[model samples]
Target: MNRPTPAADRTDRSKRTTGPGPRGRTAGAAVLGRAAALGGLVTVLGLLPWLSGKDPALALLRARSAEQEPTPEALAAIRADLGLDAGPLGLLGDWAGGVLRGDLGTSWVSGAEVLPAVLSGLGASLTLMGAALAVALALAAVLAAPVCLRGRATAGTAAAVLASLPEFLLSLVLLIVAGVWLGLAPTSGWAGPAHLVLPALALGLPGGALLGRLVADALPAVLAERWAELWRGAGVGRARIVRAALRRALPSLLPQFGMVAVGLTGGAVAVETVFAVPGIGRTALGAAKAQDLPLLQGCVLALLALGLLAGGAAAAVRRGLLGPALREAALSLPAPLPHRGSPAVLLALAGLLAAVVTWGLLRDPYAVDLTARLAGPSAAHPLGADALGRDVLARLGHGAATTVGTAAAVTGLSWLTALALGFLPGTAAGLAEVANALPPVIVGMVVAAVTGPGTAAAALAVTLVSWPPLAAHAAALAQELRASRFLQAQRALGASPFWIATRHVLPAVAGPVARHAMLRLPGVALALASLGFLGLGAQPPSPEWGLLLDESADYVERAPVAALAPVVALGLLTVLAVRLSHTAVRLRPARPAPTSVHTEGKTPLATPAQ
Candidate 1:
């Protein structure tokens, strides 16, 4: 028998050792690469605007604001202060230099160093986001645990229904009905614990609903597992079985909290704004409106950071709890798909919001004579008019329009901002994540307070709060697609990243993004309406939905319908969008990947010839 040569043995060992080590190295490289990319992006994000002295929409904005051009002296001061006089790359270098020296520049408006101002805003945003997330987690546990335990179709259905409604809309409606109409809580101002209720609810509802679904989905699977069956066969108590199942489901399920958190953050901005809560989301809004590039950039960067942290936390938790299969599956799954359709739905929604604005502008809410007002609802106005005696129907319709309109506009604008940010190299995704982790109401309050109030300001505030999730998702999806074979093929075919993202990946992910976006509409609408109701949106007599509800609260006994109309519309629109998203996913045919497991042929320790 011939003995094996050392070279052959070494080669064989090398082949055998390539399993986990190579994969581990690859993962390490990926992590390092990601870190480097993020670092580079952070540097660029901090510097680029200062270098260009322009925002992404600077041209369009400048064209509109030509009359408001800064004087040469002011411009020079601004340029010197912002480092815009330096060439673009040079400015980037200067900004980078300043950053290294711990100088983030001062706020153009405040004259305070940018880092401290940013830190303060960041702290407020964190506080609000943390509170909101805690509230959401608590609510999710309270609501989802019971429904999952029940394990019945009705419980599942109830959970689904709750999940279907957007957080912003639900919270806004409650804020109006519970806070304004009932006068149970302060509608606008940041009071005490009472004020937290509506905003928290706005944050918690959608998150809780999503958690419920995640738990529900995970629970049943866990319950059916061999371990669960073994425990059951061992005569474990039902409660014990539930506990075991939940324990098993924990890892698979918990990561969903991050996604839910992102969704809630999106809603919280508007809620905060409507309620006049001061926070980072509001600051971001102010920055966006003022085109305070540094402030806006800071806000975006902060948002992305928060998202990364949340996502990372969720991932860590998930990995700690769940099996590899569950972890991979949960992370790999794209957000639930949305219905296939044109931008028509979005456009229509925009129109509706616009119509409401027009109505509010046109309607003379002051003309109603108090002497003509009856204590009860009359035929002239089936639903009793407000103290102003404006037709309640018109008011309600217009209110719904304004509230929903503002939300729609904000959502659209926010999504666009998010998309743009997502496309940027480096820190964009992280910034998006941070934004997603924030609360909209807080953003709104700060922006409104600083910039003062107007449609432009309000819209900007809404967008700042609303855009993070969309950006995170877009960036995430793009990253994922970039890794896929199809994308690689396109790249090999000489397609640019932009072209690939726009042509192939966008179409593939559109259904899901659209669904998510649609699902978000009601919440946005509700938040917007809540703002109107609170008298922060479009101002008084704007006939905003939330405002109408607030105004009609006293007359609910006389005109329940008037008070309920806006609520009903909000609810219906939310339901329709959610359903369409669900249906889109359900209707799509599943395409399974081909599985192949390599079979190794075993050789005897020694060949018979040896």
Candidate 2:
């Protein structure tokens, strides 16, 4: 037989290890699972009218004419006309059948076909999202280039700061500075391409920063690989090597990219509301407020489809990027690089936030002075006055208590729930994968429908959706630890499952999960704010940050400071959270290596005989 080269031998080995048969089976099973999940979601949405406990006939009557009084005959006639007299099961079956036939039903409020309206809104949102994704990718490449090439620490810091800014606040700032002050772009509405510039930048900049940081953190390992070294030794150009490294790094980053895409879809709600863009998110909010279940259901289903498509696209790209050898091997990404720079900046931001909250608390936020309405900042009104002449400083202070306190509560509750469910990694991870597609805004709509819109409703909505990430993290870490060699050795020593989990697993999982949850606190606050901005959370006069932002929009030109005040507070809070989370991660105790088995230096338990 002819002697085979080493490369051929390696290729053959890789082919054997990859086993295309198993890969195809896994892919098919995944598709089936996703389809089943989608079907279940569709079923739940189809039955929503019944589950909401609100009479569609009564809601329709109110929508048509609030003056109309309900009578049994009129209700029956309305139900007959709308085909709602069908029992819940019948309605579900009919809806399911209609969906299969490409009919999304008609809107109760507008008397329009739900599918067309939903598609129009989805088209708008997709246009905006596409532009935003471009901006994000461009920004990530620019920011990460320096770090990847030169390992510049400053680039990472810049990315962190940029990433820390909340989407709503950034959008408003962009609207004011870029749209109002410089006249560089349209402030609101979606009449033309120019209208997209500000909102797209607003949405994409932070996401790009986040993505760039991930790329920067992961590229070092890729560049250090033996193939990269060999290429460099063979006189490969730096740019070409960097490009290859990026492609290598991309497979690991694809999942995060999917998350960022879904986040863009979810975040369109707040951005759309601010910019007056008629996207599906805004449409869904309107339908929710109107109790138009058909329209809302159509909007929700479209969003879900978009989310699933994003995830599938990411997976496809990842598979394309990885070679068979890499695909079959477990890729352990390096820990995130430690943030460089002084804690003083973080402390200074914390101090500023604290001062604002303290100064506001010292004054009465509810007190109104019509004479001071729209007044500029002064000694008495440090942050100026709102339209109602209430002290902006006082409101900001009090709002912190409401907004931040509720977010903290939601985070704590979510952490507990994640911990409780994390023992079942398979179930928790699967549920999280499905739930990840349901954004907080959508969840808020459902909760508002059931509980009515208020601060409590907003809190409940946020709590419902916030646990998935934490649970997913805990589950992933648990799975990783269970497969570790030390854990196998422990099992060989006759340790009970509970003992192994409690002694080895919980300690390894808790810190990271808690940090992850802490990192999400700002996002929870932002979600609550988004709900309030959409009028689904804290009503008028509550001074919730989101409500404050909403109230300040009209006066953005007259008193930009009023808007700037809340934006600054939110920005500071975000920066502080990011800094603290990073610090915590850096300070966390490292876990023992897989082969290490020193357990408090006690006499080792004897291994069971084979």
Candidate 3:
């Protein structure tokens, strides 16, 4: 054989020397990011026992056990019997060892194996989730089809309105139309596919709106890509281009799918509560109420594990699907997005929130006259009274206040706290990612259990669950903005980190923070509702919407309309919240794509929206 050519030798040397270059580094960073996020989640969960304290769980254990002695020795014996005597390390070791052997322990309340019981509920939850996910995707397609078929201007009209409403309120609307007005399906109870339709529709709509938005956002850039230009220059048809655009846009949205899943799964608590579905949410609700840590932990762990898997799958898909052009655009200056959603819808939502807050403040929900028990709506009582003579309308109003106020508080706290938490460089994303992986209901339960069930506890729980996404989004955006020229100039000029963050990073993060806050409202509201239904929210005599619904479950026939009044109010708020979120999303200033990503001699193609 002849001596190796210079080019071939150079290529071999290059290959050998360039191992795990930029792309490899990126992949490794992604893996580490995932691990870090998962670690944060584990940290939050591992600290739950300490954070929540052992007393409540111990008391619950005591009540479950037949021994009636109140001595410290007896309690310690009970704790020992239940395996609570071990230190954290030992406990973790035992738990890990058991998990390795396929043993998830037994429920304190049910005395059944935790794994099998949770698995039984998992089947139902997954079925419902699957049905809901499918409907959401289909609805998204239906919403986006016209935008692709028509010009991109078609995005901000009816679709914006549809996308704005929260999932629970949508569920209520479907319930009324399908079950009451149209009489096509049962309003409550899980019978078969007919009963499933309304709840699935409710659970799916918000997600559909999210998916639609993602599609709309992704479409413009996708159509502007070099590949799309090549296809267009070759005289490709609109249908083929639309298909190709959708394919390209979808992968970018993979990370978002996990975020959407939080809303989807969390939203299910309300859906399950209202539709009376015997799914895992309902089961988890029962476990939470009873303060059965073993069962609750098992259920939450299984659900969280599933969520982690879903998140990982989406990340992998995103990694695999990101083409060189999109990757180049990744470092590109974020593009300035066109205003694409309805502002009027957002105004309507804001008005409704004001109404709820006002109505709740004016109403005296706890005033019990005892004369108008189980009364119907009339001039004397506009929304009627419950079995205990509390005004249903007043209770509904107060409940609305609690729901909306708590959500607002949660929203405010999330943003305020986000500024601080997001200030941590590099690690903020990991913390946010971990928080995103956790289920809202699980967080709510832990907070409530620790704080001992009250409106404040409920609010705090909701805040903890809802804040992570905002923090993550803000941190990610802050990081991106930090790489900007102005920030670099500020840094070079010797400006303080805080000054740069406040002046530049915070402002950049503000719009996204606002948009995310709105989207979180419906989910947060639903979370409050769920916690109330589970008896961990709004102490008795202090009405909340979910609490009102739960209290009147047995009185549905006595005052059907009154029982439904709170639900209708919740529905209204949920709808408004959804609308506001979508509308706020419209106002987001589009990030400009960095021009430096492209090589010399070729300009990027113009997009249709441009």
Candidate 4:
């Protein structure tokens, strides 16, 4: 037998020499390690007290009773049981260790296993989300297909208007009209499928608006492509062309749909509350208000995981459908040349950065102020002010900025956090799956109750809710890219996990991630504003849109413009943001051609020759 080096060995050698910097791997490892540590902390918070007989409920009870009288022995026992006897640092260390071992405690109120309690609530939420997603997808298929194929203006406009309606408002209307007025379903309660309709509609309507736009916008361009044209000439029928069209459109669309699904999962929290559903969102809301620490922590973990799962599923679907294309595309990109800084490249980057900052500043939502207070569109204020003597323009700008900024920041942070959570060796996938099925608003409300409302709490809440999608996306993309030969080759060469994730996986996912990040901004803002409007966020004098709505609720008759202005502004901002991002992504340069140098020079390429 001829002795030869194994293919894996050769590949390993090649990758070791070609992979990313040692410094990047070290840094990524550190970051991911911290993430794992934090997840441990969260999980420990879930399990520690219950296992030790000092659960959140008992602790609260002990504290309350102690305040009322001198319960020294009881207090000492509670402290001992909680391992407070070990001191804070020791307590932290012990908790961290247990968490690493997957000992998430128990629900304080229910005294149930954290995972089971979370899963129970998650089951209901997922059912609702599934129903909503099914409806939304069906609607998108029906409405978007016609619009894309023919620009069916009427259907398109109706779709647009349908999407333009706010989720809470829509839910309320449906609940009243269909559930109460028509007596078709219960107005509240977590009964069977009937209880799902209004909430499903609430979730689906906004999602439909987004999906319809994505399909209508993405499909037309894909259909207009040269491959689609060639397929037509090759005697492919319209139905087949449409199916083929999905391949091109999906890479762009799936990521976005995933983000929206992540967001809608969070939005369902409030809807669940309104409808008195016993899902995680409702449970979380109650837990937050009651200061039920274990329950709240569990809910946050669950939401984070859920967001990741949804994002991951979308990524998986995309990869399944387009894996071959992605693999081929990876092969086509020019290998990175040695990094000598180029002035031209630097200038282009700087100009692009400047343009972005400038656009954000000019659109500084806080600048538009209406001078009159509750006045119906006087010359000075196009959109009248509300109860406070603030400028409508100024308030609108601030609120818009608040909504957009808060949502963007929260979504980004949570996703990053979730990425960290999912980066762990084994638990990430399970955590993401659990998180995808939880409700975000419930998490938000719970956090609000604990940390106190205002931006910080809201941000934390949003993070808990939003992080999972990012995790899911990153994880799935990582999984997909792993199938690429470039990656397989690198891995065979001994490239570390961090190296693969950061250098190879990240670069490929940058565009899709950025597009999705932009897509989710409006929804986050909407959720924040809606929460604020309901007096569940931002407190008084923040100039937030939701707060303005709350203040103007009573004055809708006295000055309709003040109330309607904010509503209109919120709706317009969301729709425009969706449109702008969708357009920009659709217009991005196509991935470099996957295959090159066709042997037959005259043979028709998938893309037409100019």
Candidate 5:
């Protein structure tokens, strides 16, 4: 053996301490990439007024006085006053400088200081989210306990069903059932504690259900570990064993909790809108509708920061849970086992969806009858008539196509983008994380600001934000696959990277990613519907499901069936998506489990009687 010289040892130690290793370089690059992405987002937001192609000065003049017409002198003075004459770069610089100084500027429409208004809205949203998170954790414990203790199938099924209901639809149901009929909670406003109940429940229930399912799936694995068996053999109490198992399982849940937190932030838009809570989500939607660029920018930036903070907090908590010993360890749980449904149940759901579509397609969704406005369900209108006397059944039928079709298109585009970027070496991961920080509603607000609110803008916004999850999933799977023995064998045999990726990696990754995307279809549809409900997608008379819901909300007490029609349709759609996504997973070919671990260049041989 050769010994290192003293100078060499010192040089090696210095290099170990100071050199930028692969991990260090990756971290630096990720930070720079995130910074660049954030800067680019701010720049785009700053340029929105110019991108809209509408003269802000003229709009301001009209807003100040509708009868006023724009003149060159007046326009020049207004532009100078508003700092528009400084051009896009100058405006961006000023906004960036203001942000650094804790000044968020002012609302163009309301003339209110943006910082205070945004802070107030953010406070309301944070309160709602905090309450919602508590509800979620409590619900998760309740739902997971039965499954963990008794392996109850019904508990899991209940979780899945509850998780399938979109937040907006659930909010409406809770509003009607709890607020209107039972009078257990207030229907709207953020005046007191009672006002928070329904909205928090609407947001929390689904999240809790989803979290429960994940916990249920992961806890069994933790309980099956060798250490758990040892504890049980030592005559430990069942409750004590469970407590230890839960602690062991919790770190696996942190990523999901982060996602849930981010989801709650995004779901606030529809929930707050339904409940009339003056939160940042609703404020951003209102700003988009009013073309208040400054206010919208502030709201979106605040949301972005909240999303990042949530992600970071979850990471910190996970690190704390794992402790120093296992800080760098990667742990993953098995996917939830697919639920098998009876053929009769599947047929019933299919029939319900088909009947609604066929019934609506036969009638004219656009036709109006003033005399029968807000009519109850009858022979002429199977579902009832809306405030405009439009056939609710027909609109439900046509709106399914508008809503589902748009969601499908967005999903396909997003899936394609995910596949394209999934294999990138270093940058895709960081970019995906940055992109995931933006909620679809915030993106929709920006798109609507530029293109005007419509189905196209909704689709674009959803597509932009939707790809990150799938891309991240794909990248992770691809990374794992690349390190497998079979892939290494192919590499040893001199297979080209492209050939191996296409032949081996693509097949391995695509099915799982596709199923993941399919599982997200209902979310995509809900997002589109949320935008429509906010008047940012599929405008009136288009018979879009969300637009129909928005239109029926005013007359819901008188024409409950009108609202119920679309709600049922959306619920059924969500159920269908959940069923199909799971069915696809179950139907996929299963890969054989490895019998033993293999070293790089070694094979195990029998010990031959030792």
Candidate 6:
């Protein structure tokens, strides 16, 4: 090749100088793409009601006007009055203009500015989240010490038990025991710091169990690595080594903690309902049921912001834990546990089934209260009375019946959907991925628009939105398992694809899929309660925990125990379900041999080699 002239080299250098580095250009492009996607999502959310073919005029007239049957002329008049007759483009313009001015319009139900309502709810939610996080982290830190130092199984067991407890169920149990059993804390509306105690613990403990277990397991594993032995040989104190191990393991735990934080926030729907605590999550449930577009949009946006904040904090914490030297390594962690199963599911199912039978055979939940409007718990009315003077115990029994039946139905339907669709290939993956992208809240709203509010609508909503994630996961696992040698041998032997799938692939993945389905049940429980709280699930006097919560709020101070009975019952059921999921996951062997040594049992990294 001929050497380039000095003048040619100078021109080439100038051209290179003006171009950006690869990463810089890539990041800029990503930012722009995200902005465009967000804008599109906003437009879609703003027009969701119209997109669903729900008529705002009819909805408003039904909610606001006294006339049971309005004439066509009246309906048209109301539509114009609300300016809901605007075309899609026009509505978009109006909504965007209001958004720019920091206004979210008035709520159809409350007739108040959306900003104030959202802000009020935000304050309560922030308080709950802050308290819950503090409690969880503190408790976990303390519990972690024993596991890191002595490999205490008790600490891990505690975490497992608590993590399996449902957030709502925990709140309910605490409320009843504290307010009714011992007459300890105020269980009704938020008054002062006292009210925060039980809810905070309920919200925090489930997360604490997870954090403590991870921290405990991770620290021991870190200590067992080869490098740690060097420090041990150098006569480094065990305490210092423990601290070092913690610093390494902590970085890995923060991301999960962030998820726990979000769960605490979203899971607050149950806690807030039980305690009559006004929070954005509860407000979102309300807006969805009423089909209040502006209020629901505002709540969704606020929650999205909160989620982003949690994510940012987790990232920052991860970076801090990584430090400069370990920065590269910290970015990478374990991908996933390929297989996990638990046998506790059988125990949980049996226990819950027994409890359901007991509740049904014990009393009638629909018996009306004849004595007092809101009586305290006593022999006559063990759970007390509602505002309508209904027997709290009877309603609770009926609620247990309704709640159990609904949960079982939803779980079976959702599990079958996941199994059927996930077993397929091409079309199943694409469909699941699409469903995964849509928010569950939006799906609930859409379903409500079609079916109106009832147990059926809520059940459908939960089943539809919940199955996609599980299906996507199961399908992916199936795809991975199909590549194994045994499956391949069957395939090469001329076995039909369907036969191989059923006989081999299905059983191989069934353990993990079943556990996964169980894990999703607590979420389903929350969805049911949320829909009920929002007036879309169990109607009044139905005894569904969600409906019980809604109907009991006003009478909290009057008959705290009656108002809280459902919380206790629902919480126990939820705790059982969670335990079932965890137990199910634990039953599967991690290695080919059940007795194979695990990382937790391994000696510390600093220990001398044999």
383-450: candidate 6 lDDT, tens digit per residue:
67788777777776666667667876887787788777666534444443223333344445546655
Instruction: Sort the candidates on lDDT, descending order.
Output: 5, 2, 6, 3, 4, 1
What is the descending TM-score order? 5, 2, 3, 6, 1, 4
Q: Which candidate has the highest lDDT of all? A: 5
Screening candidate 5 with a backbone cut-off below 3 angstroms (N, C-alpha, C), the clashing residue pairs are none
Scored by CA lDDT, what does every candidate get? 0.55, 0.75, 0.64, 0.58, 0.76, 0.64
Query: What's the lDDT of the predicted structure labeled candidate 6?
Result: 0.64
Question: Which candidate gets the maximum TM-score versus the true structure?
Answer: 5
Tens digits of per-residue lDDT, candidate 1, 391-463, equal 6656665555555666667666766665665454234433433333444443444445445545555566566
Runs in model 1 deviating more than 4 A are: 1-74, 96-102, 147-150, 322-567, 588-610
The digit string of per-residue lDDT tens for model 4 on 1-610 reads: 9755799788888888986664355345545544664465454444433433333535544445546443677656655665667754676666566457765555455555666767788888889888888888888787666854663323544454456455655665566557755888887887677778788888776676657755775566567668878987999888878877666666656756776677665666667876877888766666665556567666766776676677679878877876765732332212211212345643554454334334333433333334445677655554565655445555666655666677778767865664454344234434433333434454456556545567777667556545444454554455567678988999899999888888877677655656655555655666677677655678777767777766665566677676666665655544443343333333323432211111100000000000
Give the range of the ten consecutive residues with the poorest summed lDDT in model 2: 601-610
**Deviation in angstroms for 182 in model 5?**
2.3
Better of 1 and 5 by TM-score: 5
Q: Write one digit per residue (lDDT tens) for candidate 3, span 1-610.
A: 7988999999989989886864455445545755877765555554445455654434645556657656777667766755566767656666667667888766766656888888887887888888888987897787677668773635544454445444444565566557766788888776688778888887776667666765765676667778878998999998999887766666656666655665566667667767778777767767777766666667677777776677777767776677655644453212425554466766776687566556656767778878889888777677788988877767776677667778778778878866665555234444545556555566666666556677888788766545554554565566678888988999999999989877878887887777767665665676677567667778776687767767776676678777777666665655554454444344333442221111000000000000
Against the true structure, candidate 1 has what lDDT?
A: 0.55
Question: Once superposed on the true structure, which residue ranges of model 6 sit more than 4 Å away at CA?
Answer: 1-44, 51-83, 88-101, 109-112, 173-199, 273-278, 315-401, 416-451, 464-476, 487-523, 530-535, 548-568, 587-610
Cα shift from native, residue 93, model 3 (Å): 2.2
lDDT of 4 at 495: 97
Model 4 compared with the native: what TM-score?
0.59
Among all windows of ten consecutive residues in candidate 5, which has the lowest summed lDDT? Answer: 601-610
Name the TM-score of candidate 6. 0.70
Candidate 6 at 95: error in angstroms? 3.6
Better of 1 and 6 by lDDT: 6
